[model samples]
Target: MLKIVVGGQINKKEIFDYIQNYYGTENVKLEIKNDLDAVMAMQSGQFDYYIGACNTGGGGALAMAIALLGVTKCKTISMPGKILPDEEIKKAVDDGIVAFGFTASHVEQVLPVLLDAIDHKN
Candidate 1:
C-alpha cells in the first residue's frame, strides 16, 4: 500500500479529505500532520509522498519540505488559479517528485492528477 503524509499551513483537512476520497482508506495509508512533522516523516521514510498546501504554493507549505527533501524532490503543481497539465504532473512523478505542494484552492483539481501519477508509478 502507498503511504502518504498530507499537511500545510492552511486548508490541510480539505486536502486530506480529497486524498482520502480519491484513494480510499483501504488503498493507501494516510497521515495528517503539520508541515514540520510531514517533512520529518518524509525524511524518516515513513511516507511514500508528501502533499501540502499554502496560500502561495511554494512558501510556508513547501519551504521546509524543499529544504529537507531537496529542490529536485519537491514540486509545486498548482496555485490558486493555475493547475499544471496532467502530462506535467506525470513528468514530475517520473522525475522523482515525492513531495508536492499547491495552493489549497487547487486541491480538488490537483489531487486526482497527482494521485493518478502515483498510482501509475506503482
Candidate 2:
C-alpha cells in the first residue's frame, strides 16, 4: 500500500476524505497530521508522500518539509492564482519530489492530477 499524509495548514479533513473516497482504502492509506509532525514522519519513512496546502503554497504548506526534507525533495505545485501544468506535476514526481504543496483553494483542481501522478508513480 502507498502511505500518504495530509500535512497542511488547512483542509486536512477534506483532503483526507477526498483521497479516501476516490482511491479507496485498499491501495492507499492516509493520515491527517500537523505540518511539523508530518515532516518528521516522512523523515522516518512513515509515509511515502507528503501533501500540504496553504494560501501561498510555500508558507505553512511546505515550510517544514522544505526545512527538514530539503528543497530538492519538495515542490510547490500551485500558488494563489498559479498552478503548474499537469506535465510539470508529473515531471516533478519523476524527478523524485516526495513532498508537494499547493494553495488550499486549488485543492479540488489540483488533487486529481496530483493523485493520479502519484498513483502512476507507485
Find the candidate with the highest TM-score and give its number: 2
In model 1, what lDDT does residue 55 have?
Answer: 93
Cα lDDT tens digits, model 1, 6-113, are 877888888888888888889999989988899999999999999888998888778989888899999999876788898999999988899898988887788888
Cα lDDT for residue 61, model 1?
A: 76
Q: Write the per-residue lDDT of candidate 2 for residues 3-111, one digit (tens) a residue.
A: 9999989888888888898789887878999999999999999899999988899899999999999999999999987999999999999899999999998988889
Residue runs of model 2 more than 4 Å from their true location after superposition: none
Candidate RMSDs in order: 1.0, 0.7
Structure candidate 2, residue pairs in collision: none
